[model samples]
Target chain A: MADDIKILAFDVFGTVVDWHRSIMDEVRSMHLDVDADQFALAWRAGYMPAMQKVMSGELGWTLIDDLHRMILDDLLVRFGVTQLSEEQKRHLNKAWHRLGAWPDTVAGLRRLKQRYTICTLSNGNIGLLTNMAKQAGLPWDCVLSAEVFQKYKPDPATYLGVAKIFDVEPGQVMLVAAHQDDLAHARACGLKTAYIERPLEYGASQVKDVSPHPDNTFHARDLEQLAGLLRC
Target chain B: MADDIKILAFDVFGTVVDWHRSIMDEVRSMHLDVDADQFALAWRAGYMPAMQKVMSGELGWTLIDDLHRMILDDLLVRFGVTQLSEEQKRHLNKAWHRLGAWPDTVAGLRRLKQRYTICTLSNGNIGLLTNMAKQAGLPWDCVLSAEVFQKYKPDPATYLGVAKIFDVEPGQVMLVAAHQDDLAHARACGLKTAYIERPLEYGASQVKDVSPHPDNTFHARDLEQLAGLLRC
Candidate 1:
């Protein structure tokens, strides 16, 4: 069994908030003349490639807020919806801030917070995470971000930064993420890793293969299950 | 009127937690043969000079935790209490982490958090702030520290760092502190300032002549009053 973990750093987009459904709902509410699900998927599709540019040193440090805006601008043109004013586009880009939490998010976080310090170690910028926490009622002890280190997730700096913030060895901090790649990177940095199965993170029609993999220290179906497994 | 402050960055020591009383209580609990109040005051008197060393570039950036330890060592000798082992000294030095919040702190913070994104802009390092928040049930949206900025409080970078973290303009963020110097420094950096008077911050019988000088945008008796003044 793992020793007592002092800190639990979470991935925000899928694990804490249901980004897929929330983005789709926002697209639908905007009454944009396009497939909301497709729009959501297309926008998310731009995420990894954008981070790869920075990760590969092809681009200088860029925050998730700016990247989100860039993707939103391209997405608006791709969806053939040019009626949005600059102000409206700005507001639309902030949809990430208003994303709803997953069903298990609040209760699980509350339980986990009882036993350990919980924080967000997401690729999301600090501003975005802070706003999301306020909007979604997620009880984070701190909203740490890649923005603090000027690097994105899967980078050693971002993973190690969490440990540094809490002044603990990396082994004492656990990364709770939905993505295998993120957990893998954190594990490589000597941090404990938990893989949370956000099966429908892509959308309902796209059923994810939720088969267990052996790379992580803990695996759970949702935040609630993760909390239970952590004995919180 | 202040233009819809979204983030409230608080000063921690005397604002959120009663450090004087907490330290005195801890010293008393240890049954140390010394005046608890005097011991507490002596330890706190070391705080400013230590922070000034970093602020004035005399000392390379040092965290409050380490500063506290340095002062703790001298204080032990000054009080002629050499009975504590090294491990015991270390544990006792971390009393700052377990400080009890003022009566209205938790409830007021909860209320403020309903409307504004609340965080700690403390000279305390992230580790100390995180542990203190966990112990005291202070529901912070994030814990921004001087450690993050690599500069202590009253520094423009530390004050502006809070604004930068939230990607908001300085004027849109408010610094809630009990100290006049801290508020003045924040105001100089264009951040809104609120002074919460903690009359007995030092100790009840010590006769602290706290002047209600009008240097800040708002002044209140305590966190509860501050919450009401902010209409949170």
Candidate 2:
């Protein structure tokens, strides 16, 4: 399974970056009276449903940034906080752009890039991925997103699109992600699968499901371990 | 014109990499009895026509790599070269992936990337551009290609697509290239245009049209000079 892999497509957000911590920190700094942890969770809670609306054809194709903004507006109303001006709301929406990467992201990716083409395969928009890379010094050969394929994660088009872009068979591409559903979709689409353990992805207080699967081609404690396992 | 420009989109073939010289080098190293310069010219001469076929909907969308291979096959027949095996032919087609950059590419891009978002806006496919970047060390924040927009250069969609991807106005995005035709198309689409001089782009012996145009937002001798002019 590992022999032919030429492209290692990554799931962004919780896989590569500390989104919950990043969002919680930003919310805490906002001095909002609501529980920052719950606020972060609330903000994230709308992500799947928003993407589902697009996936189900109930909504037109929209960028994750725009979906995120819509979610932000709903969250603010639910949390009973509406003091932010337009500029402030815009800036707050851009917090996704400033997400910090995991401890092993840069060095491990630098290692993995030596052997495989490294890229982000995310639901995020191109601008968000590009800005996040710039902010976090994440070196991606390409910043591919659901926006590029016009479909969200779990969509076979999105998984197969990465392979088509590289002119390689889906078996020659590997999906490295923290989510089981993501890996399952990639695996179902004939790509190799690697599960990355990001224990603190949700937060210190909440548990994230990071169990291993027999079908996974590789498993690692972190990106550094994966790099080592891949002999990069 | 440069004041509001937040993204610098680049043309790759002649502007960033000397394709003529690089192809000539590879052709000469192959020890074919044909004139390497003429062969290189013949190979590139087919590029625009092939893309035009796609643009005119006479052909389905094709990647530059495949188009390059098609042109290479015809050029080989024209030049009376039939000794190459399938493996050799495949490797030769990938010569585009190994083209060397101009001396000032990496450093100047690094300097410019410190402020504005820098990316490739080329007709090349994603795999070709990604492999070329890996081989050339071109630090692009994102690799935006004609493949991404499914339109070749000089098309309004290709130029305007960059602005849409970044959620910016056309005026806030700039097209930096060596070709007058390319810059003109970009300017017509309302993107700021910067013309860089690649005097020996077509090979030292062959004269290329590198004349300046008044409509260019900026003109510089090279990427280093462009960086200096932009105060990066």
Candidate 3:
């Protein structure tokens, strides 16, 4: 596996960082009189539908940062949180930049870095990724984003963009993600796939029945385990 | 200077990596029966003129990787090195991907990372910068290339593109380079400028007197000195 794989492109939000927990914590700290868990869930819930609009051409080319802000604005209106000022809302929208990594992310990425060129092939914009790296200490060799390709995930362009960025055959670059859809899309584009189990990605309260079965080229409980499996 | 700089977009070739020394070493190792220093110098001398052709509309938009290869191929013919194989030439063309960083680059970048988001704003294509970071341990948070903007450096789009990526004002991003021409171009586009003295960027025998002039917002001897001046 080490000999075959040259680049490891990661799905950042839930796979590398615990975005749900991070958002919930920020909501709690702000004391917005809102359900922190509900706010986190609501924020993530906006992500897919927002991306779908762009993917389906209902919306023009929009960055994840702008999409996130739009969703935040809608969600705030829905929740009737009228007490917050514009500056507070703006700061709250940037909570995505302060996400904490999953427990195994740093160690696993560090281990994998010894053998592979590790990068973020995330839907998150470059600024978000850069700020998150500084906040969380994710040691990516480079941060490759959907923003770079001007396309969202699940698009062939996004998957193929990773291979193009490294100037490698699609087979040489592997997409590591917790989401099966992302892995399947990458596989469709001829990239190797690694499935990581982040069962609590959404939140601990939500029951996610992710199989430990090896559906992809590799399967591991966490990034550290994946690194060990890859013999990094 | 530090307060104003929200993003620090770097010039990769001479500013981040020691291209002259690296190419010279590779040439020496190949034992190609040519003057290694002269070969390296000649190869670099072609860079600006090659970029100028594109910038002036005399040539179509071509990536720096292709531009480097064009220069390399012409140099090979000029030097009468007819013995090289196609595979060797391909490897030689990728020398830009294996450049050695100046001693202070990684350390200074780590420091700068604390204060501002660091990214590459190079004419080199995305593949070249990504591969180079993997090989040379450049700790870039994000890699932005002319490839993304479809325009080479000294183009206002490339300088302004860096600020656009971070959603910052043009005045908030600093262009750091060893070349005064690049700094001047960036400043003309309303970006902050920092000049570093890389007197040996052309080659050892060539005495490059890049003085620390007042034109640049900050001028330093090396990345370490620049980091100190930026208070990073």
User: Among these predicted structures, which one has the highest lDDT?
Assistant: 2
After superposition, candidate 2 runs with Cα above 4 Å error: A1-3
The TM-score of chain B in candidate 1 is 0.96
Clashes of each: 0, 0, 0
- What C-alpha lDDT does candidate 2 achieve relative to the native structure? 0.92
Winner by DockQ: 2
Q: Tens digit of lDDT per residue, candidate 2, span B53-169?
A: 889998898889999999999998999999999989999999999899999999999999998999999999988999999989999999999988888988899999999988899
What is the DockQ for all candidates, taken in turn?
A: 0.74, 0.84, 0.78
Alpha-carbon runs more than 4 Å astray in model 3: B56-60
Task: Please report the interface RMSD of model 2 to 1 decimal.
Answer: 0.7
Superposed Cα deviation of residue B50, candidate 1 (Å): 1.6
Model 1: DockQ vs. true structure: 0.74
Off by over 4 Å in 1: none
lDDT of 1 by residue, A47-133 (tens): 989889888998888888888889999998988998998988888888999999989999999999888889999989878898898
Query: TM-scores of all models?
Result: 0.95, 0.97, 0.96
**C-alpha root-mean-square deviation, candidate 2:** 1.3
Cα-based lDDT at residue B214, candidate 2: 91
